[model samples]
Target: MRKLALSDEILLKIEKPARYIGNEVNSVIKDKSKVDIRFVMCFPDVYEIGMSHLGIQILYDMFNRREDVWCERVYSPWIDLDKIMREEKLPLFALESQDPIKEFDFLGITIQYEMCYTNILQILDLSGMALKACERKEEDPIVIGGGPCTYNPEPLAEFFDLFYIGEGETVYDELLDTYKENRKAGGTKKDFLEKAAGIEGIYVPSLYTVTYKEDGTIDTFAPSSSHAPAVIKKQVVMDVTDTYYPESPVVPFIKATQDRVVLEIQRGCIRGCRFCQAGMIYRPTRERNVEKLKAYARNMLKSTGHEEISLSSLSSSDYSQLEELVTFLIEEFKEKGINISLPSLRIDAFSLDVMGKVQDIRKSSLTFAPEAGSQRMRNVINKGLTEEDIINGAGQAFEGGWSKVKLYFMLGLPTETKEDMKEIAVLADKVARRYYEIPKEQRNGKCQITASSSFFIPKPFTPFQWARMYTNEEYIARAAIVKHAFQDQLNRKSLKYNWHDAEVTVLEGVFARGDRRTGKVIEEAYRLGCLYDSWTETFDNDKWMQAFENTGIDIGFYNLRERSLDEKFPWDFIDTGVTKEFLIQEWKRAMNGEVTPNCRQRCSGCGVAKWKGGVCVESKN
Candidate 1:
């Protein structure tokens, strides 16, 4: 293990020092002598943001629970620190013990998003390891990745040695245990990965060869050897109640994305919103028992002393036992000054009742995403909620004494019209009227209504996989129509309007569904000062536009152009265990204005059944 030199200290002064320092109360530490396998969990971003993620924490806690495996944390250095490392010829090291990353048995990098692809390469270069798996020697660590972005890892295929397709809870241990057993007999990295490819949900890209046609489609993907599954099914944990998760997560010194205690009450969503990839990929919702969840919350509050506790999930309002859980937490922690916050609350009058239990006063504005303005448009997107739902939801909240409400909607969805844009303004006007109509005692004066709209980006493994996104010109025009509609009203000042840059949304669409060629564009964008595009202040559209030109790839091909069912998607090679037929069926239902029942009530029969062996909660009836 190399020590941090004098130069490293100087570099930390300019960059954020907290990202490099690795002492947290809940972090994993192990004796090097006793561990057979050492796993380095790497997040391809700065440490502050990465440490804030609950997914990384869960894996860290799960693996470290085993005495045979020791897990440590590693994050990519900021550009300023990278320069110093390059000048001083220093290798990237783990924060827990300053040990070089290459020394570990498993280097598990999380590919949360496509934007972090270059950072993975930079980490490899800094760690004194080969950037590509084929270039590495037998002694080099086995590089692997997991997370939401792993579903379409083709663009990043050149970098990662293997991709863990789905949930890490079951798959991670299988890989670790396999490595330990094989290494005892003195096998090489190739030998272990070859055997690992046999395990479910593990994709060893090197063992299979991908050939592209001259027309820019996949000609064929043939397995070079007998070490692969024809279709790798993603691992699913049927019961989340028994899952191992940390009750008290590490509380950060500086406020991170989630600034309070979070309890993951559920794993998946039952609502089949056509454009939602999360709902499609993370099929078959699993809930934690109310009693177990309440106990966990009490333990976390006692250990970390966090003032606010959040009931986290795809949709907290949809949880069957949410009322009971909230009652228990409020009863137990109200005296302790703990406030409950729900992230994805459905907009309804009943929601207001649940929210009232947590916040003493609704000081902050309430937020709800109607997704589309018109009933017809909402049906096309399969939002499963009508305009009446929004009207009732807002009316309820205002009556409950909420002065302000923030409404979220998307522009440029499939089959959307300018009339749909106008309807947004009409809906806002109606909500404002409803707000003022509340009697004087219950009413809060000067009702604030904020409507934020964004261009919809079609994602993979969803019903919109073949759908085309809006071009820049189209988005701007639609946005203007929606903005003016609100202004056209005589009392428009009562309503506020905000929208994101359409160009950024388009670029996100490109990277979300792009192929290996997309990597060049990312590299060029980073080379031209596009770091932290995730943040609003630093995103440069011109740099990204120029990068696309330099790479000779048309952005429209990925974002604006619609694909046919016959056309090969860049992510076709990887299997997420959900069938194409299921997604296509949902797409048909979206067009017919039909709503699929929630997974808890009826099985939509999305193809997780291939691996689940039985129907998802929806289909049994």
Candidate 2:
């Protein structure tokens, strides 16, 4: 029997004891002596949040499948446990074996969001590892970062030894094999890194050097070693159908953020929304086979015995075989008292019908991410959604007995005007009015239209990459305009408006486009008790501000100022299949308030065609 890392006293004291304990259902256990590699995968957040992440689950299942590799899981301890661990001088440990993380070969962290930056430092500090990658010794585990955030890894570059550029399903096997080979050859850490650097999608931060121009822009980013490539190409799995998927995912002892079986219907998105980073980076859009999805759903549902199953995708409605798959799932599991969840679906006739069959119309609220309000604003963002689409969709949902409607929009979009901000309220009011269009007897209840706005943060690898961001004051002012507009609406009682924290948006903007200099701010902030900045209650803006002041790093320099089209970005060293030229064209189009067609409607020549798969090849077939 494996020993527990924490004592019963310590476990009982923590809020969620189940988070620290290992040996959950479906979790893999392996003999340490038998496995050549001991890999620890981390999500760098609290257990519930980490457990919900689909990427970690897929990678965990993939890694543990290798007989020679023993992959375990770890998450940043909660604040209570963090304090106790520090007070007791206890090292952080992985869940599976309750073994110290320092003993692992690789410490792979999935950086899903910018706010989790300080938590990365917390993990390293508690694990008795060097905070900076350069300061680490040979015996320390090699820390690698992956996920969407790695597209602009400059802000966290100094901490991470390396980054995996794209899909985990593609090049991980080759990376693991290379590591084994280097180990057998008795290669040093640096030697292994140099060898790994040659592989596609592998970025060795130490092997690369960056020189800034007089104006703080990246003048040159070149590889210092011959083994490292100048441009690290993003690895993609063209055939997603044959890729590794967890049939029996580890069931957490406690309820997770997404405490349900997740069936990923597809990878990437067809909608070319200008503000979206995922849409740009994950181009072409590949779909998993419906037959295979059916099989996985059955197995996952059977193994985990989860009450609900969610269809995971950037846009579930775009899946070619969605109707067939959803029908299969409903038929296969609906009788067994399983709830089917389909997110990211456009509200249409078929969608409403499908949703009506699966979801309780009265209890569940229908969500519409129009992303913009007015037609002109929608065109600027290439949202491919018009006012008619919103009204018609809302009308359909209302007719189908969905009284509660959740509308999502962005406050400070590029080229946004006061009228655009007011339009958000006007649009919500219009939806409420549409709800009342039905006769008094036909209506479910008073229509509830809840609209939310999040400040736009310019992310790397999108048309918005070169766009400027607003100050906290500016963002809040914009939200205030919308709130004021909501009060003046004819159907004011039915309309509710909510906006995201402007302060958090500003910080996220800085990190989104920030360069290597921002790393100091993160480390200093972590030292100043800035863990869990993503959580609204725990986020300390003053400490983060103090960190910036101490580091002499200017947030405005990273976010507020607009970049020249020719100005090289910090993330220019990596290629995400989508070319910068195409992004520039799209940026220009956005400025002209022109809408670009999606992958199905027309090819805008975004340069993802090189993969020769997904939506790019769907037309030919």
CA lDDT of each prediction against the hidden true structure: 0.80, 0.92
Go through the candidates in order and give the C-alpha RMSD of each one to the true structure. 2.4, 1.1
Clashing residue pairs found in predicted model 2: none
Where does model 1 exceed 4 Å of error?
Answer: 1-12, 360-362, 527-529, 609-611
lDDT for model 1: 0.80
Give one digit per residue, the lDDT tens place, for model 2 in 36-130.
99999999999999999999999999999999999999999999999999999999999999999999999999999999999999999999999
Give candidate 1's error at residue 60 in angstroms: 0.2
Q: State every prediction's TM-score relative to the real structure.
A: 0.94, 0.99
Clashing pairs in 1: 602-618, 603-618, 603-619
